[model samples]
Target: MSDQSSDASSRPGASLESGEAAGAASGTVPEPVSEGPGRAKAAEEKPARASTRPVPAQNAGPEVPKVPAYLQAQPRPDVWLRGGHQPPPGVLTRLRPPSPPVIGPGTLWSVLATALLSALLLGDGLGANLLIVAVPAALGAFFAARSAARRLRPWTAVWAVGGLALLAIPALREAGWPVFLAVVSALALGSLALHGSRSWPGVLLGSLGLFPSVAAGARWGWRGVRVRADDSRGRVRTAVRTTAVAVVLLIVFGALFASADAAFADLLGDLTPDVSIGDSPWRAFLFAVGLVGALAAAYSAAAPVRWDGITVRPGKARNRAEWALPLIVLNLLFAAFITLQLVVLLGGYDKVLEETGLPLAEYARQGFWQLLWATVLTLLVIALALRWAPRGGPGDRTLVRSVLGALCVLTLVVVASALRRMDLYVDAFGLTRLRISVAAVELWLGVVLVLILAAGVFGARLLPRAIAVSAAAGVLAFGLVSPDGLIAEQNVQRYDADKTIDIDYLKGLSADAVPALNTLPEPLRSCALENFERDLARQEAPWYSSSWGEVRARDILEKHPAQNHGTECYSLGQESDERDGYEEDSYDPY
Candidate 1:
């Protein structure tokens, strides 16, 4: 047995001899072992160290060296990683549990109040009710979310204010498109404000994601309820039981009392809301819209995703020659076009009409749409140029500014040319919805170009946000200006130029144009306002369904109602030269 032990101990790493022999290669010292009885007895007398450290298996691979605790890298507090258990080698993993939803009693009450207000005040029509619904919803969201909002920047405040201001447009104007724009823009701004999104793409994504967040909010609210079940279950049950008992008692006793007394039933009928089965679906829809919208706003404000981290990879940049060449050529092309346009504009119409062999109206219509399209395409080109242009050095930035600046200047000229064409077209023809709509769009595009030019001079980092805000402002301005009213005014003025008017066209205008159309003399006024007066007379609208424009129109029509000239106005419209058959294809601006 002694010989076998000796042989076993002779193996590498088994005894002191083998350790001493391999010390030069392994660079590690082995612990001393007792070779005799005396030494063994001494070892047993000494205190033993814990053997908590891992031991290698006999057939296992070579053990890795352990790093000292002091020398190993420490985990950083700010850094976070994501994955399940057994993460990949060299990868740091962090466990991030989703935050519990914040469904406090106040938040619940706010959501309920907003929903109730929406059901009562909205869906009658987009009138006073729109402003009424928006104000409470915004206030509810603000109160619910104010505590959790991370960075309520100045721009967020601006957006919030802008959203409320936009909602008021419906109460001010009766036009459908303007009201539609106001609602969409208000929602987008509200989304941006709730999330405190500053970066352009972040703002855009947050605004767009609001609709989908409603579903997420529902789940969040459900999870919150489940999480607090232990704390809230008894109270909820008690409240529900009390409410159920009260409702049952009220129904049974109220029915009996109503049968016993007619006066009491009449009072109850007046006190109760007149909610019919027909309106239940619509009111329910409005309530849901309000509830979900408020909850989603609060959710986003409390736990906004770090959307600024999302970056779009720019296109591979090109050298200055490659980038500047096409842009310079474009600038030259714009310059040449501008020179020609100046000739046509400055030399007066007589010379151009003679040269082109076209009528004034045809000449006006020919290039207006094309110029508008060119302006739009030029903006796209500038965007792509900025994306792909080399921006590595000061010289590169200067080059970008110079080249893009010149292009923008020339594009401004193109914008001017387009507007000029539209003016001429409007002069020859009469104003229509399409004409004014396109004109507004073209003007907005011009504003965007000017903004880009300013960004080139200042800094381009905030350009996207600036452009977005400008667009919102433009939409608000357009809605406020009341394009239909302007159309009516312009067409009425044109009636003076040629003693003929399209009374049929004016009759089709909304209540927004009533004030303008009312200025026409006698039969023409009656003919133009006949349809609007008739429509307003038919509506027995409540105060919530009344808009400023509609109310004004009603008062005006009441003071000076349309006369019974009917067929005489129609006969005059038919005989007028304004109804002369013109080719619509030639005049189609779009």
Candidate 2:
């Protein structure tokens, strides 16, 4: 027995094995030894401590501490564990989930003030009230951003001015839908600009995710209000108290005075707000919209999403020959098309007309929409080519810039061709709203292509924002020009020159066209102005809801009232109601 014990103690790792065996028998956790140079010394010292403890019966091991089952179900620890190992202390508590952002008093006041302003200024239908409400809303956003301690980007000033200009469109135009779209876009741009969003994806999200952000802002604002409610010293609480007191005083005193005298009651009736119970829901809706919009802007400004941090993987670049070949082929095609256009423009149209046996109007109509679509497709092609273009060296960049720049220049020519065709078509078959709107779109597209070419010359870092700005500018220009009015003026001029007019088509125009329509001959004038005058007779817009366009149309109609001559005007039947076949031709691939 002594020899066997001596043999066991003489074995390698004998101390560590005995210590671990002792720990297992005792059910006491063994201390971990330090790795490296200290490990041998620790192993040597461990058995001395183990030997001093009294040996226990196998079944009489020390009691393991009772951990509750709920406590046993702790979070998964980061480090791997061997059999019988416990996680380090406080691991579970350290891994608790973080809380969301806390909204504050300044943000709360900005939201409340903006909501109240919206309730007072924007009742229902838009007018100068749009501009009035916009000013306060913008001011709210400015102050909110300031309160959040966010620095406004220099670009924000441009968007602020642009938003104000877009809001002015509602006051100037009688058209509702266009103005509505402009206002929505303007708001989106303003919100995005507040955050200094730079990427295409960011711009798209800022525009499309606007309502979702509003809801998020509302929740954030509610959290702020709740948090502030707990603190008596909060400014929000003080403001609420003051407002409640003021409301009580006004209700008590105003009622006593209103009941005291009939004259005072009449004066009270005049001085009292015109809001009705029926308008309460709508006004509340507007108030919420204002609150959410301002909150969205402020929240975004404070904690703007790092959208530019998203990395876009460029398409696999082809070798020079592989990349250059397709682009060269495309450039040749564009050159060929441009050559044909130049031929037509340089007075070779006569020969083409003789060969096709079609009149100038037919020739122009057949090709205008096609050219417009081709120009759009060319832009897509250029975008793809740039995406995959080789950037291996200066030679590659030069090749890309040369080829894409040529493509853009050719596209501009195509734009001009499309516009020329529209002009010819309009001259032959009088200008209509569709023709004018398409012309505007084509013009704006031309502007975009020019911008692209400029981007290629300079760095393209700002290309997305520049394109967005151009689109905003185009919409603003389109709205301010009043296409309906322009259409009326152009058609009237065409009628004078060619003794032809689409009076039926003209009759459907809005009151913005009244000044131009009023210049027509007696029966035509009365016929065209019939709807305009009737609308004016029915309109009872209050001062806040009255637009500049409506005011002008009313004055014009009052000066030259319609003679109720639509029946006689219809009998003339000199103008064709078929308008133009552009819609049918739009589907034609050619």
TM-score, every prediction:
0.77, 0.78
lDDT of 2 by residue, 461-576 (tens): 88888888888888898888887888899989987775467677788887788999889888778888888898889976755667778899999988879897645877653533
lDDT of 2: 0.75
What tens-digit string does per-residue lDDT give for candidate 1 at 1-590?
78966775675434433333343224454455666776655444321221232323442334455686677976554424553244353311111124534666666667677788788767667776777766666665665566554555788898889888888888889889888988899888888787665566677786764665577677766665676676778988998899899999999999999999999998886554456789989999989988887777666666555456567788999999999999999899999999998888789988998888877767777888898899889988987998899978999999999999999889888888888888877876778888888888999999998999888878877787787798789889988989889999998898877745667777877899999999998888888888998899888566676778899999999999999895688675565243223543343443
Against the true structure, candidate 1 has what lDDT? Answer: 0.75
- lDDT value, residue 101 of candidate 2: 56
Candidate 2: residue 141 lDDT (0-100): 61
Runs of candidate 1 exceeding 4 Å displacement: 1-101, 149-151, 225-274, 576-590
Q: lDDT winner among the candidates?
A: 1
* TM-score, cand. 1 vs. native: 0.77
Candidate 1 versus truth, CA RMSD in Å, comes to 10.0
